[model samples]
Target: MSINLSEPIKIVFNEIEIDDYLPSIKFKIDINIKQFTHLLTYSGEIWIDCKVWDRFSKGLNEGKDTTLNDMDDIFIIEIIKNNEFIEFTWSIKRKDPEGNVMTAGYSSKITDDVYSVIRNEFINYPKWW
Candidate 1:
């Protein structure tokens, strides 16, 4: 699949580009779209496993008529040193006339080898921008 971005964000770790949003994809978690945040330069909250939900961004869509929830494209995670240049990708979900997400994507790192749901319910651990 072709990758696209509304804003070409670069992953700048410690003032270096370790990876960009359009880099080698590891794996995409099947997290509900609603739980995502639009974090780009902020740190995230710590999960129960101590893994922190770091940052995120509104992703770029490649194909036309593609909504954020389509989940056909893989969301790229540009792991970097400096949080300011970390690359991320997401879709534009809900919006008002001015075009703003009622909610945004946040970072949540997988603490343990968790492959199942946590607490049997979806959680929205707030991320700071």
Candidate 2:
């Protein structure tokens, strides 16, 4: 789907906030779109698994983790299209201790071009952002 890959774009992981001990980790991601876009406004949130969260928190407290790159978190993106909010989601999965996969997996409705742009933004971060 021919996205303008050359257009300048920026994606930054701003801050992490935890709401509860059911322990949802709230993150703010900003995508600076300086080029083509059909979206009016964009926002996103991701939830990390408890195990991953423990690891993340431990690393944070220990002041060692550089980035959230090694996480298998669920990512959710929302866009204002046609004056309405449309939600999209993507996730990573892995086998459990019992050799069974566990997750309330998700799906997304965003187009290939949009997904490509978003993925590219993160894939290039920490090195080129």
Candidate 3:
């Protein structure tokens, strides 16, 4: 892959979640290009890609369901190329050794000069509630 030495790519903080939450839990993420997202271009240069996930637990069947816990969910993010697929995986190892999957991680193309805000999942504490 060849990169255009002439084109100066700059990163732009398009989205932010400094004061945000998932469900009721106080979740946060500092999404950045190069630092996180590592999309390789045809020029052999990496595009910006910083992906995040929801840490929400669901379908309660626990002995203690009084409060939502991050110790219960394993949210994730995934990435893929043109024909390849980016995938995120969810698993619960704390609750159960053979954890259950909640949802496929949300993934997107890594690119510079762009950013996004992802909601971290948390059960019980909803923005609505």
Candidate 4:
């Protein structure tokens, strides 16, 4: 396969999930390149506020499901290319038990830049479409 260096790269958070009942949710984030041929995946435990999880789970139980569907869900996934390697971040948000907000994100030379682009694309894509 041929690779295009001039192509604007975009990383997409294909899916994200938080396990219920765990004091710290064991979450998994799935990522993929928009136009390239790479699949990035991350899994780890994130500390989340019990109240927040309860509320979210409650909503899900009430039929207010908000599962991520690749075609319709909007995520921040812009590639930041560097000489060493790709650096990116994820848009996952978690509220610590102390009410502090933390993002389920990562970045490094070995990782792809996952920070969202908040330019025209942000306005064009709704949270849920």
Q: Predicted candidate 2: what Cα RMSD to the true structure?
A: 14.6
lDDT of 3 at 42: 18
Error of 3 at 107 (Å): 2.0
Please, what is the TM-score per model?
Answer: 0.19, 0.27, 0.20, 0.27
Clashes of each: 15, 1, 15, 6
For model 1, residues 63-111, the per-residue Cα lDDT tens digits are 1111222122222233222323332233323445786544334343332
Q: What is the lDDT for 112 in model 4?
A: 29
User: Candidate 1, 51: how far from true, in Å?
Assistant: 30
After TM-score superposition, the amount by which residue 40's alpha carbon in candidate 3 deviates from its true location, in angstroms, is: 27
Residue 89 C-alpha lDDT in model 4: 38
Model 3 is weakest, by summed lDDT over 10 consecutive residues, at 42-51
Better of 3 and 4 by lDDT: 4
Q: All candidates: CA RMSD in angstroms?
A: 18.0, 14.6, 17.6, 14.3
Scored by lDDT, the top model is: 2
In model 4, pairs of residues that clash are 76-116, 87-113, 88-113, 88-114, 89-114, 89-115
Evaluated at residue 71, the lDDT of candidate 3 is 24
Candidate 3 local lDDT, 52-84, one digit each (tens): 112122221121112122323342222222334
lDDT of each: 0.25, 0.39, 0.24, 0.34
Q: Order the candidates by lDDT, highest first — what do you get?
A: 2, 4, 1, 3
Q: What is candidate 4's lDDT per residue for 10-112, written digit by digit as tens?
A: 3322224443554333223333334346544433333333344344334333333222212112222333444665443335554567998655443333332
- Candidate 1: residue 112 lDDT (0-100): 19
